[model samples]
Target: MPDTSSYLNSLPAIFSEDPFLGQFLLAFEQVLTGLDAAKDEPKQGLEQTIANLSKLFDPSAIDTLFTDDEKTLKAFLQWLSGWTALSLRADWDTGQQQRFLAEIVPLYQRRGTKENLAQLLKIYTGLLPIIEEAPDRPFQIGVNSTVSSTISADTAQIGGGTPHRFRITVTMKSSSTDELARQRQIIQAIVDLQKPAHTYYELPILIRTDTMQIGSRSTVGVNTLLGSIPTA
Candidate 1:
């Protein structure tokens, strides 16, 4: 239709170069162009998307796009965590989640022990974690015996709480209720994952102040934990 003369010329001279027929062909070509145009955006969009497809799955992107609607983002991340065989807390923000995604698949297999529990708590919360196994029993290590001012000896059994009872204490860098609550939730999630199935635990979070600490006080949650121990 656009090159009606060329079309007619390609055919034998016997074919008529009828104006109406040329016009009809032109309209038909216009209709085809419109149909293609209708699909062009999505089709081209898919091509570009396929080229840079990694951004869709990028863990960093998870925060920005989905953060506005928490429910949707949580749902999406749930699917991702499920695939990775990870037990993730819903409250974890973008950065923590990104870190979690970056961590190895073996973390799930490495759960259910004090070593792994403390390691994971440090990783997720960026705080020192002290894990005492059978805390009700008398302390085997000298430092382990020192109870923090926060702990109530009367409430806590001499050895621990339950048969498999353990206690975890972490000093808080921020006294803000919001930050503390968020950390508490994450800590609980990690504890839930790492603790033995039959065991239960007590989590004591202390609000640390600048006044307390120099030498031995600096090392808590590892070999030495500060209980009623004197501060330097």
Candidate 2:
């Protein structure tokens, strides 16, 4: 198929002038071409098949086909994510996924630290998350602790740090409930995947209105990036 001609064209000089043989070879070549396209299919099957078989170890080479096939891009992204042990969010697009793959590996050395966690959160949410490695106060009895019969243990632990425990706060402008819920889900997933296995952290979403008022939020830290610092 290379030149759209049959290899029999190079036949022995004795048979080269055979008209019937020439016609047969040309007809057979056409049959093979149709079979190639029908059996294995075309670009679609070829792209996905290559992606599935290859481990995506060569990003530079595979990037060539990214624009050609969406399934190939997604499969490669997932393959790289599993390889790096990073549980990327489902909503992230091509650029975000690639950037995370590049950055997350270097972050492994700084895993479980405030900088590491904060950067990972930023990568997904586009906001610099506040990571309190050691909260100013731990869960205390009768002093700052709230007395409640319905306090769930899984609820975030705010204003507190205990053994292998910390708190994370991400402040954003007021948005739709659906948007907030989606952001919270993505943040939780990122924290759960990136945090130390034995460690626990509180994840609080602080919504700041345009006038710098709190919306379903508690305390505002001194390092807020969205608005002016609050003064007493």
Candidate 3:
């Protein structure tokens, strides 16, 4: 307080006497003010961009994107189509394609086995297929017979003269005409891929009744056979 006025007067004279130093101080002060005003906007924009990039590269978000839900599955498939070389069937819907992607690994693990075929049928139709193989010894006359003579019926062969034959039966509840037709197409496509090469196979679609009344006093709560569509 003793020399406050003298010190303040001396400070102004120090800068006013030097023109270059005065201009430099003025420019430096303006630069600092401008930096203070502009700093927040660029920082906010950079933070927003970093947040968006984090979400795009998040592992959990990527896993959720490929989950089994229909909408997500569709989006995943569309994205996968860019990188995957496998050809997807045009007739398969988003649900079927999702299932195919989910089960493809397991199916390949057990490929060429009956379990693989059954699994594929179950996945596509929601029904466990009844797989039947033809008689191992078509020439055998009877179960107790020891005769080994070959019968002419044994000569009969299936596809491409191969003796092996298989039959797959799919049971379904009766439904609308369009639904049944759609199911038939799905079943046919699955069977076509699951069947063995050069071997004859039959796919029979059996419709069953949900419930039936036997009489006025009795109700038979059994699934009755409706009809069958045989495919060879």
Summarize candidate 1's per-residue lDDT along 116-215 as a digit string, tens digits.
7777787777787777655343544553555442333323334454466777878776467998998898898878866778877888787665453554
For model 3, what is the error of residue 116's alpha carbon versus the real structure, in angstroms, after optimal superposition? 0.7
- Sorted on TM-score, best first, the list reads 2, 1, 3
Query: Candidate 3, which segments miss by more than 4 Å at Cα?
Result: 1-73, 78-100, 139-162, 210-232
Q: lDDT for each of the candidates? A: 0.61, 0.64, 0.52
lDDT of 3 by residue, 74-125 (tens): 6656555434333345567865665565556557677657788788767666
Q: Please identify which of the two predictions, 1 or 3, would achieve the higher lDDT against the true structure.
A: 1
Per-candidate Cα RMSD to the true structure, in Å, reads 9.7, 8.6, 14.4
lDDT of 3 at 39: 37
**Candidate 1 colliding pairs:** 135-159, 135-160, 136-158, 136-159, 136-160, 137-159, 147-227, 148-227
Top lDDT prediction, candidate number = 2
| Span of ten consecutive residues with least summed lDDT in model 1 | 34-43
lDDT of 2 by residue, 1-232 (tens): 2323354657776675666676566545554433234333342434455555553554444466577797779777887788887666788776667778878888989987778888888887888676765444445656546533222332234554346777777776679999999889888887887788998777777765434443333344443335443321
Candidate 2: regions farther than 4 A off: 1-55, 58-61, 65-67, 135-161, 212-232
List residue ranges in candidate 1 displaced over 4 A.
1-78, 84-96, 135-162, 211-232
With a 3 Å backbone cut-off (N, CA, C), the pairs that clash in candidate 3 are none
List TM-scores for all candidates, in order.
0.48, 0.56, 0.47
